[model samples]
Target: MRVALKYICEDVDRHGNVRCYVRAPGKRKVRIRALPGTPEFMEEYQAAIATAAEAPLRQADEAKRGSFRHLCIRYYSSAIYKALDGSTRNWLRRALDEIAQEHGAKQVATMQARHVRRLRDAKAEMPAAANQRLKALRALFSWAIEAEETKVNPTIGVKKLRYQSNGHHTWTNEEIQQFCERHTLGTKARLAFDLLRYTTGRREDAPRLGRQHMRDGRVRFRQAKNEHRNPIDIDIPLHPALGESIAAAKVGANLTFLLTEFGKPFTANGFGNKFKDWCRQAGLPHCSAHGVRKATSTALAEAGATPHEIGAITGHTSLKEIERYTKAARRGELASQGMSKLIGKTTA
Candidate 1:
């Protein structure tokens, strides 16, 4: 059923609880808890609509001065939120907005550690989602505390959920070979695969890469995610595999090697969706864009590239990320050396 405006829709699941939310502008759809017909819900819809002009200024200057909603609005306007990349900012806004709508009237100074933990526990099944929500909340509280809007940050000691599972399955050499064999050179699939595997850039930055970044056979770009905080200029020499794939594909005047069906440059999300289709077509549903990045790091580590070398190419700020690969490579190297010495003794 239609809820309030053209922007909102009401959803009733199999169990029959209703949820009303904004349905348009794609990414900005927010599910506000109040029902469509209620006076309170109408007021909220109006407030959300009204905030289009000046969201934070309205909150700070309005009557609900010390409320949690006001604090969130203020935080959104704060430099902390502004510094985040597009995707991160979107996620943070959604998380903070939900909290604001729920506990908007509550005073930020009164929030305790218990409140933070309870918020975390609500998304118990998905550790990542739970952590993301908690992270956004922490940023908000931390910003508030710094501004002296609140005396204590509620999320100070609340720990992230401990879970076991390899996050994204890192593709092995065999899997990469299989994918390549299935999707031969001269195809978009191969080009996309080679672009990510060869460049070792995150999926977010993949769509932004093109011929312009190339200089003396190296691809260079500032990483989109954490560019400001951990700024590093990435310049990776073209991998032979990627060079061969690109040569075969004969990519034309398009800005990036990957493009949509319409031949337009892809948005970051568009490229990911297109790549997933390529993987499924190759019967390598288990493989992914990010997995290709892992494979690149693994190859470098196995080939004896230092953490600093890996960081230079991948724009990684911390040694911790490449430590696993380096450690494994060291063990393999030692084992090979020891086995060779043993073989020499037996032969002698």
Candidate 2:
């Protein structure tokens, strides 16, 4: 309709109907009755009106071209799918679907900082969840801007919540010694634990280690985290217990070091479940395969290994991360030393 509709905003009428009011000079006010009046429905109705009002303006701006749906499809096809691994790509796809439903497809060109804030607020209870959503949205908008689909990125102004680190559980020296004593070699779970405690490799990387990685009296392999393709050389003499375990678990060509009951490479979650079961059988407190990495780091620092030396073996690129691991170990050692001195003085 070629009517000069001036949107005067929306309100709930006496009959509890959502009525969107628009005015035109020398004409009766046009009232569009929306669905039952609720805060959410009312907001959606108002947004719909705003979107319709802005359509002509958006069409005029050649720079603001595609809808949110079009941009999202382009983003997934272009860079996002390729950049993310399988598990992560699945998560981003699910989050993007929810975002599209809440905010209409056509509102991409008209999206502002407020819309980003709304999305963030909606996901506020779970900061990590919110951050992931924001990251995916930001990446989509960035692609849109680069592809000349939009002039500006509305997500630029959205702030991220500060991340608080909740430290993972690590095995105590007594616990580690007891667990090792209880668990014997030849078992897949025990072998996996032995390798993790010694090498400090990630759970994913542990299965990938093979006879080829063991050479020149050192274990060498590229880290999966950065895919830097630089081999980490570990000089810490391989423990005889771990050595025997590896030798026993040796597989023929075309097989990984660690495998599920089905004789295939252990998927990350499958390995974790087996590790947890092993811990339970050994009567050890709940500790993850990743905890072995922390335990190894602590053990190295306690044995007077320098941060740089530890980083080389652990494949840590930065000294800061090394210090954090060592500092936690140091704190426990220092506290024990102080208590020993106090006890000795009192007894003497």
Candidate 3:
């Protein structure tokens, strides 16, 4: 029996049973314990290849292939997509799916400016989703152009949707206290809340943060979002209150500070769902994991922490972002002080 030179690797088990595996880079191996040239062998091989076809970027030469879907496939397989954290990749995947479903059959070169705007406008109601989709499209075409899969990037000039509010709402001190009262000292909700409020860690990084990240009186971890482009190393000094909550939760040697009912590490998305439930229980439906992060930033800025100082704890590489919060805090202080002076003058 003659086996093809590619995708199939022959190996033997310790029990002396021989097997053929369908091997693809960055994918799990599929074993078919059948001899080559048999119908069973062909069947398994075709099935495995079909499954492998769904994953992008495995074939180094595929960048030059087919349509928008092909470009996205290559994009997904590229180092850029691989570099994203789980949550980011999940969003990118949805964006890619949206792009492929709409214009996948079209040639990459045919994606003009108007076409890009059309896609962006379609998602105008959800401004954030629209912007994120545009981001994914930009990444895809940018990769396509650089990879020589396309001549131009249509998403390059397309503007993001204009929304009224800033990204996430900051939690108030009163709301924080209310949440604390409901969740209590020893509960997982309190621990999780403090982990964000004190450490200034994003939701994606917060649940994953554990005792392992703690060393020399600081908790350290890399920021997961867009890590390839602007990787951030967050080293926050351990806060005494957060430390107390950690002990109260009996976090133990469980590696992660927060665990599921089954004693496994909480995934970013899973923790978010649970956290939402915790918020609802506390009658704070408007609150979010990111809101707490913003709250901490606002608190620090209001207390006169510099932008760089705030960025250091929050792992925000962009000073502009840090400054936006600082500027807002400064305005609030100015308004209060100015009003106080006016009232004092009136009384005198």
TM-score of each: 0.77, 0.66, 0.78
Better of 1 and 3 by TM-score: 3
Task: Say which prediction, candidate 2 or candidate 3, comes out ahead on lDDT.
Answer: 3
- Of the two candidates 2 and 3, the one with more favorable TM-score, higher being better, is 3
Where's the lowest-lDDT run of ten residues in candidate 1? 53-62
* Ranking of all predicted structures according to lDDT, beginning with the best and ending with the worst: 3, 1, 2
Evaluate all candidate structures by whole-model CA lDDT and list the values in order: 0.76, 0.68, 0.79
| Per-residue lDDT of 199 in model 2 | 82
Top candidate on lDDT is: 3
* Count of clashes, each model: 0, 0, 0
Best by TM-score: 3
Q: Can you give the lDDT of residue 302 in candidate 2?
A: 83
lDDT of 2 by residue, 1-348 (tens): 222324555677799966666553433454555433222233334433533443222232323346676566666667545455434555676788677654534657778888887887788888888888888888777777787767879998788877785456777888787777777677677788888887888775677666666666667666555342334544455667678888776655533577667545565556677788888888875777888898888889888889998997888878997898788778988999899989857753
Candidate 3 local lDDT, 181-205, one digit each (tens): 9999999999999998888887767
User: How well does candidate 2 score on lDDT at residue 344?
Assistant: 50
After TM-score superposition, what is the CA distance of residue 336 in candidate 1 from its true location, in Å?
5.6
TM-score of model number 1:
0.77
